[model samples]
Target: PPPPPPPPPPPPPPPPICQDVGYKVYRLVPKPSVQDKGGDTLELELPSPRSSILDTLTNMLCATCKPLDTPIECLIEDALYKADGEIYVLGRISEDDLIPFRSHKINLDGWADLHLQDFLNLGFHDKNKKDNLIVVY
Candidate 1:
């Protein structure tokens, strides 16, 4: 009988390339202070309150219906100077609702202050010193 032909060589593997062709970046300038409603509310004390607030905003953005087909990359831009007792709630707020009230003390009060080390740990670099800003890409 004729000798069996040698088995064919295996096919070459695909090239080392990223699956994501491109990315759509979205920046969120979160409020420095988030309302502390008290009673078992998870309080995240961060060096940059804006970063924490960004998380809440990101979650809300994710929950909403897809506005675009392309994948989104949410970026957080941290800014200093806390807005005294500024509580950020999840949900849509009308323009009229944004009016400032005379009352200083509200149900949601308190600020999560983050420091240099904390920002570094969270993969944010100091974008500006004078303005006190940190950014995460």
Candidate 2:
């Protein structure tokens, strides 16, 4: 029999010209547990929400992939929350937690968690705060 025909070429990427390519908006709605207990109108303003963390986390944590552009978030054996110009860390994170996290055994959710504004208050924004207790560069 004769050979099959070749497949079509892949589509080109969208142009770089200005266009309303639409946007993705995220809202920090309370979880089911919180919503069930929410009696009144509770408002919450979340801080620096990234478009995606799974891919970045998977690459950085599992593989040796190191992204330079993303902000640095790590944990150290300390009690204070460090939010310098480069990194973010919650309560102390010693070798115990760091080892597992580095090995992809656990995730960063409970022990290390804070809204965007809170983190920025310690890092860059430095605005809309009272005393600036968080400490930023």
Candidate 3:
């Protein structure tokens, strides 16, 4: 019997879309606390209160990694409803009152009114290895 024919050559790799530009991305994370337990409230200390915006997204996997498709304004207990913790939602005015560090977002979907817990719920835990917001506690 005769031998079989050889297989075709492999295809070339896809062209590059663009160069990998290094962007200074920032993710809002709850200030690392050695201990947090004073009722059902979680306090996040942001470096700069006025410079950053906080908003909530629906089914978003990561807060810092991507832009929100639809962001809803936070009423009094928006974070409480969206959060997966025992945090008692307070009027954002209170949270904003005591932040001790600067936090920033990419400003997609009107980043003007994002909430603290909302940002955290989106997966800014830094455990997510995306190039977006990488926060390590």
Candidate 4:
């Protein structure tokens, strides 16, 4: 019998390097704490606090080895309903807020919002576990 023909060579791998440019939405979940409303009747803190998440994300991006755009947005507790412990932090916002944060274009929407409780449910582990700013990114 004759030998079979050789198979075709495999395709070359993709480019060695490429710029990393993209947008990411993160949900900031706070760490656990003993402080709670004296009773169920008491009001609970909003899911993802706007100010807190904004601060944390700003710091994280700044500290990142590969720094990205600036002037990011913070959409905390946008949802109308209550979602257990998982908050949803959306990168998309309304057109109004989008203008000012043009520097950080990553923030898709001008009106973005997030829920703190919902964020925690995403399983964001923190060392201190004290109202952690959970970033879903």
Task: In model 2, state the lDDT of residue 30.
Answer: 39
Model 2 stretches astray by more than 4 angstroms: 1-35, 38-60, 67-75, 78-111, 123-137
By TM-score, the better pick of 1 and 4 is 1
lDDT of 4 by residue, 78-137 (tens): 321112222223453334533332222121111244444433343343445543343333
Using all chains and alpha carbons, the TM-scores for the candidates as numbered come to 0.22, 0.21, 0.20, 0.21
- Model 1 scores worst on lDDT over the 10 consecutive residues at 101-110
Using lDDT, give the best candidate's number: 4
lDDT of 2: 0.35
Shift of residue 112 alpha carbon in model 1, Å? 13
- Give lDDT: candidate 1, residue 62: 32
lDDT value, residue 95 of candidate 4:
45
- Range of the 10 consecutive residues with the lowest summed lDDT in candidate 3: 81-90
Candidate models: Cα lDDT each: 0.35, 0.35, 0.36, 0.39
After superposition on all C-alphas, the RMSD of every candidate to the true structure, in Å, is 18.3, 13.8, 15.0, 15.5
lDDT string, candidate 1, 1-137, tens digits? 99999999999998987455556556655544555768877554343333465554443333332222324332213321112332223223332432342122111112332233433343233344332221221
Model 4 misplacement above 4 A: 1-31, 41-58, 62-64, 67-95, 99-137
What's the distance in Å from true for residue 53, model 4?
Answer: 10
Those runs of model 1 whose alpha carbons end farther than 4 Å from true positions after fitting are: 31-137
